[model samples]
Target: MSGDYSIYTGQKRTFTIPDYVLFSLTLAISAGIGLFFAIKDRNNVTSKEYHLGGKNMNILPVAMSLLVTFLSALTLLGTPVEMYNYSTMFWWLCLAFVSAMVLASVVFTPFFYNLQVTSVFQYLELRFSKPVRLLASFIYILQTCTYMSFVLYAPSLALNAVTGFHLWGSVAAVGIVVTLYTALGGMKAVLWANTFQALVIMAGLMAVLIQGSIVTGGFQNAWDIAGNRSRIYFHDFSFDPTTRHSFWSVVIGGSFFWTSLYGINQAQVQKALSCPSVSKAQIAFFVSLPGLILIVSLCCMIGIVMYAFYADCHPMDFNNLITTSDQLLPFFVMDILGHVPGLPGVFVSSLFSGSLSTISSSLNALGAIIPRDIMKPYCCPNISDRSITILSKVIVFMFGGVAIGLAVLASQLGSVMQSSYSVYSVLNGPLFGLFILGMFFPWANAWGALGGALTSLAFMSWIGFGAFANKVSTAKLSPVFTHGCNWSVTTTAMTVTTTLRTTTSFTGSTEVTTIAAPSYPFIPMYKLSYLFYMPTAMAVLVIVGLFVSLITGCRDPKTMDPRLICPLFDRLFPCMPEMILRPLRCGVNHKGNIRNKVYEEADELPEKIQPIDANGVEVKPPHDTEAGVLKGGAINQGFEPIDAKTPGSEECITHL
Candidate 1:
């Protein structure tokens, strides 16, 4: 009764034993390699060292880690299904890259760099309340828990369906292994493993693509078939709120999504921010842009190739196929290609890497968030760093446990694989909105932050639910020529010349299966293109929060806590750098700006902070619980960057 059961019973013949064994081994090995790294880096690094890699990490692995975070078992298994079912999202990933990298470099990275923060949620506490911070952290934990489970469970289902192993067993082995290494090694370990796994995933797909091409034809043949028959639907510029994949939805929604990811998402944010220098982190953003284009494009081509290969032996029912849609990729690999020994192992390892990298990053982040956001603020305000580190390890177990447990009944999400992004999008837009408000708008009060998040959440839920029901009511679209199609996650390269079109005109003798729920939702959710959900959510948040801030006009408290501010910001945001040109500038927290650090020496004026049209808000801006929107920053109030000696000798704190 799990979410995706439709896949198994009817598609059993297509999924075989060899596939399951290959899939399981990948998860087991990924976990083992991660643990060894954890132990090696154990003593010298603290939890900060463990989780954030002591901020001394390199960029190659960092950028790769980001790439793996976005890709997962879903990409491995479901992408080809998308290729089979509709327009393959080959370039869909490219769209994500253009938007992701630009935002990270131009705007998003600088915001974090300016602040010098560890957790994205921590920014909320500085401007708002502990409650706001905790809410965000809780939402993240919920997001990752559900997300990681499905990530792990997806390949498990693929393994079981192909190899006929129990789903729960697959979930347990992968879950335990990923969690163990993540708990031990922290962020560095996760990134290193991510680098390893990313390679494995790419290698696996290359194998499938190469063998599949020969089985089907050559590149030229695939091009002929795809060009002649396949509907690549590269760009659908006709914009309609109801339509799933369109240019506006991609460009606009994508912009918002990347902004939130780079700016607000804790797991993704930590990896880049963890870098010792700001320049390295910024480079991480640039590195992935090209990679995104290459890999995603290759994936869709592989899908077409799969279709061509199986033109003859043609497995499962076309419309009658019972498996959840995402399972298509796995079904192909196991049932069609599992006959090759090393190939299966490579495929499964790649699948495991995608899931492992993302989940491990999440677990490491949860460790940081729990102590910083909830546990320390409310319960143990003064808990030592060591205690905090120990507690984070415990949280990793909990995060993994819940995800694995849910994985057992994963069939409930109907399309647990696709729903992964939706789960995140639904919450992220609003959550990130709150933070956006804080960073940009000094006037945004705690109450506004709380209200903005609540409102955004409500709006997203309503739309999300409607979309889900629409998916339920609509009819499932299947290929017209049923004889050629087979059932498995990524298997579909048949090249018969039937016009690939679907129309819901079932009449007399047909027994119509209820259309599987929209795999997501339809409430102007705009087709099943939930890919842009987070950015869409972010849009709603920023707009709504800003409007509200204008109405209310409240402001963030001027006073800061001793521990709330990081030492890094003081140097960067010089009006508050505590240390001067000496060794004192090292890692120490400071309250005032470096400029302000002149400490009562210069008769200075406290600058007026222009209100921010801050980050995100629900349906309206919440910048003004204390109240505000976009305006000049606090430093703009008559302050200019001055060398220490000139300002010091003159005893002049000019508000320039």
Candidate 2:
């Protein structure tokens, strides 16, 4: 703990503890607020109101949600660990992250707006067959489940080590809180809570950073110590496929990962799409960018300060503190901030909040996508309104179980986000390409899409493992060193306590058996990074899918399945497809395929009967229960109760 240093100490190693009643009361109050807002409004326009906080959430929470979702707790703790390994070249990753948000807003988001989608993978259905849509949704759900579970578990581990909270108790309590609120309030609860959690998290970190700095003798001392050869700014400009985090590697490779994650992943995009307008969704994409800089900067800076505090002052028996860099922040919170009465509880609650807020959105997204994308196509052609609502809830419960299971399985992985995403990219990276093919490459056929997608995944997986296998062989010579020289001096003492620390190692000694090469290969926790891996995989899937689709002579965009397309895209760009579908005249043996402009004008006239399906394609009109709380129909069915607005509850295909 930085607070344990002599500079800040005047016999303050153990500060005054809070009253037991006060501690429990504050804890209960914090947990209750989180629980109440989440559960109380479950069925109250929850699909929209809860999932997106009814799309009427304030800017603070929206900003917070965006920050928390993109920046995980692992990020909060892991960047520091990496800085302890190398230097501050890791800080440049901040720019890569922000650049991704900009790309999403400018390049990829417009395409999603055109799809007119309720869920992200709705594009798959439009571009391919039922199998494709199911394939993408299933992959995404599996990925999210693994991810959310790991995130949940990571923080519990942090808290358990700090507060002595039972490991399972911490996991289950936090998990239950997340599930109850998310399950009840839907997206609305999630974003609002996210907004709250984001702020608290920042507060806790900033407090630790400033307090840590003050203890280590202000700004210049901290800088001289941290700004040495170990934390040097530049590394290499060349691309190295085998090693991760290079200049070229991040720009191109990271772009692919971000495109698939932000562009298509339902968990992230769904929150934005749940908003009422395309403009709002687009603007929100932009809003999320700047926060990345603040987030990454603060996280990396904390690592710098941590080195300053622990320079010569290693904790009790622990000689090597760098490996526990991730643990340092939480330990600081408990040992330092815990001295303040409500602050410690607030900090812990804040930490738990990240897992809760992000997980809630994941579960809600899984609920919305699974039944609508996969089950509805097979179980019942025309689903009744009542059943549709019931099915969505059932999906929420079912997926909650899957997420928990993934979390438990992922616990052994060193970092939560890294482990889950590595597995996800194999499934995700290939899917984004198919979505792009369907939207822009009108000629992409289902068969071509399938074949190309498979080819892409195959290539990406090979690259990921190849890099993983030959990691030690690729080392550049410009020897990296100047291990932390700042550690010898104590801020309070006139005498310096010098010691050398080139690399961090475990404190207690243990016998080691070294293996030459190729130990166990397919371990899940030991996979490549999700961020880079997914991008490589996604790029291959789209390029191959489009090439194969076009080569197979499937030139008709109309042949593309509707399930793969976004509903938002269609709603906004309806005319383009219609113009293509509108009949063209051969001009009475004139040998030309000119569109009949006059006939097109005539067809634009309103008809007496409305087509059940918008496209002139064969589909079983889903049988809906009597309209429930809809503007035009009777018997409010969807989510509205009959008493309030039961009669004329026919849904008019509403989205956020």
Give the whole-model CA lDDT for all candidates, comma-separated: 0.60, 0.54
- Who wins the TM-score comparison? 1
Cα lDDT tens digits for candidate 2, 376-483: 666675765446555666767676666666666766555454445565566677777777666555555566667777787777667555544544222221222223
Point out the worst 10-residue segment of candidate 1 by lDDT.
Answer: 625-634
Compared with the true structure, what per-residue lDDT tens digits does model 1 show for residues 1-656? 12222221332333235544655566656676667776787666465676677777889999888877767877667667656655543346567668667766655665554555567775665455556667878877777776777788887777665555677787887788888988877887788888888787788888878876765557567555544443345656766644455666666666666667665678878887677666778888788667666666668877777555433323344433335656556666654355565566667667777788777887888888877777776799678777877888888888778878877545677666457667768877787677666654444555556667877888777666656656533333333234433344434332223222122222222332233543443233435357556655655666666566556544323322212223333324446533462234332123233332221222211111222211211123324221111111112112232343442211121111
Stretch of 10 with least lDDT, candidate 2: 585-594
Off by over 4 Å in 1: 1-25, 310-322, 441-443, 470-478, 484-529, 554-656
Query: For residue 180, what is the lDDT in candidate 1?
Result: 91
TM-score of candidate 1 to 2 decimals: 0.75
